[model samples]
Target: MSLHDTADDAEPRGPRGIQSIEVGGQLLLALAHHGRPLPLKDLAREAGMVPAKAHPYLVSFQKVGLVAQDAGSGHYGLGPLALQMGLIGLQQYDPLRLATPLIEELAEALGLTVALAMWGNRGPTIVRVAEAATPVHVTMRHGTVMSLRDTASGRLFAALLPPERLREALGAGLDELATDAPFQQALSEIRAGQPARAEGDAVPGIHALAVPVFDSLGRLVLGLTVVGPGAAIDLGPQGAVARRMQQAAQALSQQLGWRGSA
Candidate 1:
C-alpha cells in the first residue's frame, strides 16, 4: 500500500488522542507564546491555520473558558479558566523536587558541583547538592547556611529580595552595611540580573557562581549555584560557565511559571 494507507493500518505506539482537540491545542500554544491578545487573523497565522478554520476552534475554546476576546479591540487572550489552571499548576510545583534532577544533570554535564539554595529562617541555606564525578574539596553540604556577606549564593539572595525583606532578614547589620560603597555596587549589579560570584573567599581555592531563580509572581525562589576548584570554575559575568548557569536558572524559573526576562 501507499505511505498514507500503511500509516493508517500501523499499530499505535502510544495512547491515542482526538485529532481535532490536538489541532485546537495549537491555537492555545500560539496564544501562550505571544503572551498578549491577538487579532483573529494574526492568531490563525501564528498557529499555521486559516482564519476560517481557526474560528470554530476559538469559539469552542471560548465556550469552555479557555479563550477570551476583548469587546472593544476584538483581540483574543487567555481566559479565566486558563489563569486558574496555570495558578493551580504553579501551586503544585515543588522547587526542590524539580531542581534536584536538573542540578544532577548539570553536575554531570559540566563536571562541577551544583547546588540549590533557598532562604531559610537563618539565611540562604543549601538544601540540595549534586556532586561532580570528581568533586571539589570545598566544605559544602546540605544544611550549610551560606554567609550573607561572603558567598555567591548568599549575595544572590540578598540582592534579589526587596529592601524591606532585606532589612528584615539582616536587621540592623544591613542598615550599617547599606552605606558601604562596594556593598551597594555589588548588590546593584546582581539586581540587574548579573550572577554573583565568590573567589577563594567562602573557601580557599574554591570558586562559585550563583544565578537567581524566580517564581511566577517574580519572587526570588532560590539560587542555583555552581562550585568547583578555583582554576576550573569561570566566575566572569559573560564566561561559559556563567552563561550555562544563568540559562539553567532561567529555564527553572520558567518551569515555575515565571514569564519575566532573567
Candidate 2:
C-alpha cells in the first residue's frame, strides 16, 4: 500500500545508492523513535554508524536546524526545523482520517468494538466505532455523549484534560451515582498512566478500556476504547488487547506530532 512500492520499470542506479540521504534518514528515524535527546555516541550507535561518519551528517543537519546539540551536556535532539516539518505534516492531516484504518485493524485483530471519541460541543462524544464480526447488543453509536463519570472514554478525558474542558464535560454528562471523593481518586490513578475502565457503568453487561491520545502540545485529542461483553473483554491495562490498543493510540499520536517523552 505504500506509494513508493508501486510497480514500475527498473531504472539505472548510482553505485553508492544515495548513501548520504539514506544515512540521514536512518539518523532522523533514530531520533524520532527514541523520543528524547541522545548523546552523540548513542545517536551514532542507534543509526548503526560510527561517530566519525555520523558527526558530519549531524553537523549538516545542525546547520539547517534539523538537529541541535546541547552545548554543555553534548546531547543532540530534534531541532526547530524538524519540528516545523512535523507541524507541516499535521497542517492538512486529520487525526481521525489517519486513525480509522488503525482502529479497524485493532477491532478485527481483537474481535471487539473499537470506539474513537473526542471532546465535542456537548461533551465527550463517540465519533466512530469499528465493530468485529460477532453481534454485540450495545447501543452506543456516533454522537452519543458519554457519561463523564461512568464511561471509560469519558473518564480518560477527566484524567488528563484541562480543568476548563473537564468542567464543561461534567456539566454535560456527569453520572448521578458518582461520589466526589472516589471520582477524584480514580481520576488520579488514571492520570498516572492507567487505562480508564468501566464495567456495568456505561452499559449493562458491557466493559471497556480506554487509552488516551495526545497532541504535540500535550493536549488530549481523543480516546480509543475497546468495548465488549464484560466476560469477554480483558479489563486490565496490562493484557494483550490493552497493549495492542495502546500501540494503536500511540501510532495516531505520533501522526499528530506528539513525542511522548521529553
Candidate 3:
C-alpha cells in the first residue's frame, strides 16, 4: 500500500485504547460486582477468561495496589488504591451537579418546572430549579426553605430521612408533631414509597409531587419536585407526572449507587 493509503487506514474514528487494559478492566469490574474476595478460578470465570490468562493481569493489579490476594485463602479483593479511588469518586459526586441535567430533561419532557431540594440544617431547602419551556405560576425559588408541614418536598424529607436526622432537624418540634395525626399519616404514606403530593395547599395556584433520591447507603440524598399550575399537571400520586418522576428519580438514585428497590 502507498504511504497515503497506510495513513488513511491508521486514522481512528475515536480515541484508541489499549486492548489489554480493557481486558484487565473486566476483571476489576467482576471483583466490584461480587463485592467480595474471589479465588483465581472464580475471578477468571467471572471475567470470561481462564485462570492462566487472568493471572498476569492480577499480578499487575497487585503491583499497583488495585487488587490484593489473601494470604490464608489466596482469594483476591479490591486493594487500598481501589478503595482510595472509590472514595475520591464518591467525594466528587455532587448530587446537585449531577441532577441539573436530569431535572432540565424532566422539565422539558413533562412541560412542568422541576426543583431539587436537599435537607439543610434548618430544613428542606431548594437548591436548584429547572424552569419549563412555558413558565409555571409558582412561588418557588432557589434557597427557599420549604414548610415541613405544608409542602411536598418538605414532607418527602420528613418521611424518608433517617429518624436521627429528622430529630436533629425538628428538635423540640418533634415532640409536638408526634401527636399530630395528619402529619403522622402523611409520613406513613410517604414511607410506603409513594411520592409526596400537595395540591393548592402550599401555594394557591400550584401543584407539586415530590420523590426521594437515595445513595449507596439507601439514605435520602435529595428530593426531586415537579411543579406546575393546578390546571396543567396531574398531581395525584399515581398520575403520569408522578410515575415519570418516580422513574427518573429511581434512575438518578441508581447512578448515585443506590441498589434498593424503588
Best by lDDT: 3
lDDT digits (tens) for residues 28-50 of candidate 1: 99999989999999999999999
Summed backbone clashes in each candidate are 0, 0, 0
What stretches of model 2 exceed 4 Å from their correct place? Answer: 1-17, 30-43, 62-65, 68-80, 169-179
| lDDT (10s digit) by residue, model 3, range 78-140 | 999998998787778888888999999999999999999999998999999999998876678
The predicted structure with the larger lDDT, 1 or 2, is: 1
Which model is ahead, 1 or 3, in terms of lDDT? Answer: 3
- Cα shift from native, residue 50, model 1 (Å): 1.1
Q: Rank candidates, lDDT, best first.
A: 3, 1, 2
Candidate 1 stretches greater than 4 Å from native: 1-12
Candidate 1 or 2, higher TM-score? 1
Candidate 2 clashing pairs, residues 3+ apart or interchain:
none
lDDT score of model 1?
A: 0.89
Q: What lDDT score is found at residue 60 in candidate 2? A: 94
Q: Which is the better candidate, 2 or 3, if ranked by TM-score?
A: 3
TM-score quality measure for candidate 2:
0.79
lDDT of 1 at 200: 80
The residue-level lDDT of candidate 1 at 121 comes to 76
